[model samples]
Target: MSVDILIIEDEPGLSRMLATTLGAQGYAVSTAMRADEALARVAVDDPALILLDLGLPDGDGLQLLPLLKQRCQAQVLIVSARDQESDKIAALDAGAEDYLTKPFSVAELLARLRVAQRRRQEAAPVTQCYRAGELVVDLDQRQVSLAGEPVKLTPKEYQLLAILAQAGGRVVTHAQLLQAIWGRHHSDDTHYLRIYLRQLRQKLERDASEPRYLLTEPGVGYRLGDGTA
Candidate 1:
């Protein structure tokens, strides 16, 4: 299927390479070298996925992540030269879906793109229920099940899962979850998120330590994944 993709990289050579490659793959491609231009293009194009390079000329991609997220619901995949563990975690926390270190092969990049595309396709708005493998979250009737058995959940637990379900497997930052559930004043209360997420995992996951549905994004927040991968 044809997909709209945005390449937000500052390096001219790298950006051109990406645009050419993606265009050849049947994707509609656009490029931006600065954060401002990226935002403007996003407003006009409404891309489905964004391949972002952290070291933009105007501002870092880390700084632009939240803004991009707020402006459009495009899935962001950070493709950067920064290979530090901390950089990956920071990008995830800033709301990037996946990270790829620089000097990657075409095969590796294509593999990553496949995963992102699968997630985006799965995340498409559910008309009634959301299914991730055996787990089912019935949005229309407010019910949840695992392995075809009913799963009892508190109002808050169900609410949290509902939010994640609606997200369509994308990472939902801690602040976003807190504000949605607890209120804007409580958006920074990471403690609440920790408690609630833990509780939800206990109920939803076969092994809470190795969660699938209630996946943790380390210092960032959480996302719901099929976990088959």
Candidate 2:
């Protein structure tokens, strides 16, 4: 299937330019001029990835990140005019997988989208059984066990755990996890990630406070003790 990309940019010219460029590159493109509109668009058309502009007329794109994650399965990459280092860090910290400042090249945008698409395709299927440390998740069988004893996971909780296990040891960004487990449109729902992570720890961690297997990268993402890059 042609990869679908959503462009949430306020600039009409930029949005049209990007849509034209990506559409010419054989991608299915969708554009939204405001954060609220973007959310509404995501609800209707499930895009594979999103190109987000930080400063929106209706609301800040950063604030909408967690909401997007909870509402739609979208992997968001910030494409905005904001140039401050703090802006970049804040966006990344807020769960954006990548950041691209204004005046970016169309070629570069295409390349980055290619990378994101490839990564998504290359990802191992989130499946029934996953093992990391003493925790094992049998998703298909609806089973979980820690150190050989049966454990329980809510549907969302199990999904969160499965994603971390699939990530191996490499950090799975909050956005990535949100997109994987929740949906691309809901990439902004960090609250869901946090809540589910806590639940997973309670069930799988020897000490939920000082977890070993489900390690958090502070503001970035999560990783399993197993080996994933």
Candidate 3:
């Protein structure tokens, strides 16, 4: 059976209310009151989306956020009573796709769910291989080559390259690329990107100083060059 929603909230009343409300909308909903239970449920249910609460009986949900993101394919939307900006940022940076403070309206929750689902759909890959100039990226094969010569890459290097190639020449923001490769916690870690980008240019470009295919957008982000020499 397909599970669309998993509500990982400790409060029985709130969990039941959310389950009832979402079930009424024709979504298959599951609930877990503890962190371990939620992890097990996620393993079994493989829900498309999760409504998580940070304050749990057994553990802090913020600590569990990265684990959940690593283990599950679900888009986590944190619904918690923690209203502090730090809490919100920490949850988000820990990989929660979105954060919702408690006492939230059902309407807003549903709307945000819709937005998350839409974004997921948009981000889904439509193609496997991307080509620009002499560089060829076969995403499915997890390989990159230049001028038909195989180019070995570290996992992180390939990840950064794949993200840029996936953009199809459009600029991918530093934050977006960082989050995609290094998790949301490192979204501001541009130094990592810079170091990796430099390495990628060395391997893939004939001239690392004047990069050909890996184009930087200065203050914005980076994108694959327009297949031009």
Candidate 4:
């Protein structure tokens, strides 16, 4: 499963920005504009981290903070325009993991997320070179090959293929692949997958029209096979 995140910001533009930014980093993101909606999402989605704004259309973020904390185990990171010291103290005391005033840098936001998620990832396995049939993925050296020859791939194409390679022949959902590539920006966009997969097969397969390795799982997702199945 992918890392899940919720952005509780009301601004459409900013919400989209955060969702897309986080989504591309391999997070499964959901958004809520109102306090009630936020609460419902918290109870359902159970996000790993919540990026909250102090001002909501239905209620003050501060007033809703305690309610959110009481219901879920997520780490709340307040992203607000309120920069007063007292405001910060109240939020921290109310159980926020961290706070960032408005107009924050994306770098800092990502850094804070890493810190919040560090503990959960303390035992994740290190990625090693992978091989299946004629395909070879040397993640450490950042290279891929088909059969005995090198195959050139665009950065996005490589990312798409690497994700499948890492799946170890198991099917990876379409949403997972899209989120990793463009975040939530390409939700329900099947054409993106078609284009990239076609490109990958053209380079990796002996005949793109009759793919032997990149197999589609009907309505489910895609899987990589060693062409022996």
Candidate 5:
């Protein structure tokens, strides 16, 4: 049977509580008490999401973030006692999609999990052809064009553009973009995003200085230009 969620938490009581609660809600939940065990289970279970706690008897959960991201497509949500801002940012940059400090209410945990599942459902393959002014993205084909001409983009740049395009006109936060592209550990590296955004503008914009399709929201994030000529 397939697992919908994997809880990689070392605390037996908390693990049982999570499993029991989530299972009651009609989710197929799996639990692992150590990092190595979690990795092994992930390989076999093919879970859609993971609830990870950083402190483990064998290894640190934060250290496993990148490996888990590389090995599986599951969305990882960090559940740890480390409440420091640096720890949260580090986890986010390391590839974790969300972080919930300990002492959190079970109701909130369930709500967050539901949101993550909903996003996955929405992002699942359907017909996706995005357009913003002269730029066109055929998501199904993984191709892009500018003013009827094909445009070339590095894998990372394409990923960035694809995310913005997927958002339609809504703003994609810096943390979101960074976590999506470079992993969670790089969330605070806004400079990296800036450098890439400049490259994208140069390649896709008629005038990089005054971009029309790709727009920046100072102190917030970025958005694809509204689909207006």
Candidate 6:
């Protein structure tokens, strides 16, 4: 499949330039100047990845992260002028797969895209089961175990857990997980994800109040335990 890339930038020139550059690199490109329009495009035709700018006309890019992730199931790479350390962390915390400051080189953007795509492609389905300390996930049977005991989960909860585990270590956004597990129709149900994540933490965490494996991305999404490559 041709990898479709959505560029969410308000600057017309920049959007065109990015589209042209990325297209030349053999990617299908779509551009949006506003968050609402971007969200609409993503909903109708989910892209494989997104290049998002935080300084939008209608809303903050961070606020739209979940929507983009959930509604479109795209890997978000924040492309913004905001260069604060807090901003980068916030974007990452919000479930963005990566971040790029403005005035970025097209080469760098493409390189990051390659890295993200590689990580996703290399993800092997959990064969029969996976164990991380006390947490045990049986992919085939759709069952979980904690501290040598079985733990029951709702269908959504099980799917969420499975997504995180399969990620290996990389951050999986709210949008990606939502679309993958619940389908595009249920992508906007952020509350459902939060509730189910909480349930999963309660079961797998030694102290669900202070989770170790099911780590929250705050405004973004959740990830598996902190172990990342």
On lDDT, the stronger of 1 and 3 is: 1
Tens-place lDDT digits, model 5, residues 109-149: 99889867865675644689876677898888999998899
Tens-digit lDDT string for candidate 3 (1-229)? 4499999999999999999999998889999999999889988998899999999999999998888888877888999888886676567556677778989999999998997786566456666788778899999999999999999999999999998877665556777898888888997889998999999988988888888899986666787885574
Best by lDDT: 1
Q: Assess the local accuracy of residue 79 in candidate 4 as a C-alpha lDDT between 0 and 100.
A: 98
Cα-based TM-score, every candidate = 0.77, 0.57, 0.60, 0.52, 0.63, 0.58
Q: Which ten residues in a row have the lowest lDDT in candidate 3?
A: 118-127
Output the lDDT of residue 156, model 4.
Answer: 96
Write down the worst ten-residue block by lDDT for model 2. 162-171
Judge candidate 6 at residue 50 and give its lDDT.
90
Clashes (backbone N, CA, C under 3 Å), per candidate, total 0, 24, 0, 2, 7, 3
User: Scored by CA lDDT, what does every candidate get?
Assistant: 0.86, 0.76, 0.85, 0.81, 0.85, 0.80
Q: Tell me, by TM-score, which candidate is best.
A: 1
Which ten-residue region of model 5 has the weakest summed lDDT? 118-127
Better-scoring candidate (TM-score), 2 or 3 = 3
Candidate 6 off by > 4 Å: 1-3, 123-229
TM-score of 5: 0.63
Q: Write the per-residue lDDT of candidate 2 for residues 9-36, one digit (tens) a residue.
A: 8889888988998889888888899888
For candidate 3, the TM-score is 0.60
Residue 35 CA displacement from its true place in model 1, Å: 3.6
Alpha-carbon runs more than 4 Å astray in model 2 = 1-3, 124-229
Tens-place lDDT digits, model 4, residues 127-199? 6566778888877778998787888899999898888877655556676788779888885797899999999
lDDT for 94 (candidate 2): 69
